[model samples]
Target: MKFLAILILLLNILSAQNNIGIDSLQNNTGIKNNLSELRTELDDIFNDPNFSNAFWGVSIQSLKTGETFYKLNPDKLFKPASLIKLFTSSNALLLLGSRYQYRTEFFIDGNISNGILNGNLFIIGSGDPTIMIEDTFEHWLDSLNHKGIFSIKGNIIIDDRNFRQDKYGAGWLAEYMEDWFAPTTGAFCLNKNAIEIKIEPTKIHQSAQISFNTEFIENYEVINHVITSTKNSAVEVKINRIGNNIIDLIGKIPVTTEPYSVYIPVNNASQYFLNSFYEFLLDEGVEITGNAVKLDEYDKNYDFNNTIPLFTHKSEQLTKIVSEINKKSDNLLAEQLLKTIGFEIYGYGSTSNGIKAVKELKQGMGINPNNFIMADGSGLSSYNLLTPKQVVNLLAYMYRSSEFDSFYKSLAIAGYDGTLLDRMKGTKAENNFRGKSSFLENTRGLAGYIKSADGEPLALALIVNNFLVPSQLANYIQDKVCNRLANFTRN
Candidate 1:
């Protein structure tokens, strides 16, 4: 009788934990799962005109029990764009620490005789790109005019060695160079390495003249053929290279009281900087007779002299840069961070090093680098490609990281900040959704963490590629699918 009772008790215990039998079968072991049903719904959603031109991938993993909730073409690679910055910022903080600061040094090469330096001037750059963007050239000028140096008796030298000179990305789009998307290089980028081009109304026709707050660093002739338009639209005046040092500005001017000048890299950057400083000194009651010169090393003659120090310039905080890039989706900031990482890891500011670091970081997470092709930190490049599965995998791996808080803190919040500020409104996904947004013509992507109504924590990545439809339609489709996921009542 006791033996009979033991057998019955064991059977009862097995039946109690049905997850091993009925539960497993229901979750695709015992039977087909809701996941399969969700996929069908997703397909219907994708076929809608709102999503017809879209090439998309979505991977969702349940955080509660480590199960995949839904998936569609998760392995297909598509451009991730600025979403790639998640890798750059995360790895940078991981390997380089959270408080790493790029250094810029002021080294004297000549003796200062009665506040007059008789030696060459050198400004060494260590990849601190954000300098003096707060106002204009005047602030930068004042920062360097300290110690009462009336004149620089030598050439103005710039040590760009902090990052090796590699002009641009290897396969970067040709037309991208003309866009402000093409960033200015060098160890030190003053004012995002761009100058302001303003077009304000004048009392006379063709009387408009070019102007910048900073003194001219290089003498380049510029011709403005911009016709003033009667409309109040904002029109940009184009600047083109004529020969070597000459730039021609031509375009239509809108009837507005604003100034516009495209800030471009000065030709022969070293000499241009010297001339600019020289002009500033002249304005500030200082005279500089020496020309700009480039040399191999620090001038040994003036290193030992007790030269008076000029004013110092401070860099924008790393937190601020991250806020701009990760939270605000600033491509320029992403580009700058990539350059800074390249300089730190490979001794150069090219995208190659940044790409390599991201690849390596993915490998560390046990992922294949081929799953995604990273062209730049900012998704502005048409060349960047990432699979939906890869994005989900990255999000999952990052979620498990010890530094996950920082990573999450960097993402744009839904209906609150970043690219999703206007998305998921008036829905359960609102405020509950934290994700990154990507957009181009027919391309759209959203990936991040979420919680279903069933109280299940979930991680998801929804990517759309080749989207040719209107943005509103695409957004509507996304909203519908996301609503489905957010409303799930079970794991």
Candidate 2:
């Protein structure tokens, strides 16, 4: 018995030298057989010149049987970038359930008679992040249509007094508001409260046709320097908005495409939406005497207070949003959803509230929330620190939840959609893996559970950090870990 034990120990040491993550799988009776191919694949991967200097880690577990198939340097903490959305969304589902909705309303303070508003009309916003331009306008127009009124006798009002309008997530990039990063709002925002500029090629003008679909504030100056006509078939478009509201276009306009639209960031979402609603009213033959203004305090009493129910603007379900934001790594939607999670659970507003909600949800999930330090709900913060072990441990616990289907489906499938859409293809890992990947300059991480070729389960969390190599090499190491796991066969 001693000699047999010595032989087993020798084999274990040899496997250890291979640096294969088969330590847990080795003793499993359900594993197909003693394996060496996983080690060989890992060796080839680690030895690759592409990953020579990068830091990376992986921890994989099987959902089929709830066993860790393999792991490599999985305990290391690394920036999760957008993977933090997983925690945010999971907490949202668990705390709020799936069917919750955000609403944008149209309220009135005056009487409606003779098809005209006798008082001020208000569009009350409780910070509905999903309120898009077309949708908001449509609701405004529809509200008028509902009243059988095309004109208003009074001013238009935008009540943006749900949360504090000045609140913006701290630690966010300065460029956050310059792009579709979305504005933090207390009242209302449409199409993320941005403007759209469309350029069309002209046949006779010294410049291309410049058009604006959204409210063009005086702060923005449009320079029509684009030159395009019938002869010059190629057209170029460049936006030179150099740190202010001015958008300078200096290029040719394409003739093949119809005038297109894009949502660019606006200065103040609450005010922007407020101004646009009036513009909509003017177009519909509504004339108001008073200027648009925000209420000092939210009106406690309104016409709708006693009115019967009418459908308000609703957002997409949390599950759908989670699938898009997590699997596809959508930055804006994920951030908004995270903020929404905060607003819903904490009885307050802002991303900080969302961060607090995340911590609480982690505790509720039986995870020591202290083990992870997430500064933001979207994982966009470099300060976000997470260990692969903690993530995998969460996955293991979630595997037994009643909402497992909703949670697992939220992950990106390798070789399919989401951030993993283009990865893990043409191998055993193809369509057999689902996970999230996160990276910053010097940090790298991959988390989620994996399934074996024979359909056994594996839960893995891997992170590599403090490396000086390019992140691409870290990603290369990440792919290597996946490749190694794909070769696993159950005994």
Candidate 2 segments whose C-alpha is farther than 4 A from its true place: 1-40, 43-49, 64-66, 164-168, 175-177, 182-187, 202-208, 223-241, 249-263, 297-311, 439-445, 462-477
Model 2, clash count?
23
Residue by residue across 114-161, what tens digits does model 1's lDDT show? Answer: 767787666666666555534434565455455545577776676665
Q: Over the stretch 265-370, how does candidate 2's per-residue lDDT look in tens digits?
A: 6667777777776776676666667667666434445445643332366777767877776686766566666666666776555667778877876776556777
lDDT of each: 0.64, 0.64
Q: What is the lDDT of residue 361 in candidate 1?
A: 74
- Shift of residue 107 alpha carbon in model 1, Å: 1.2
Q: What is the lDDT of candidate 2?
A: 0.64
TM-score of 2: 0.79
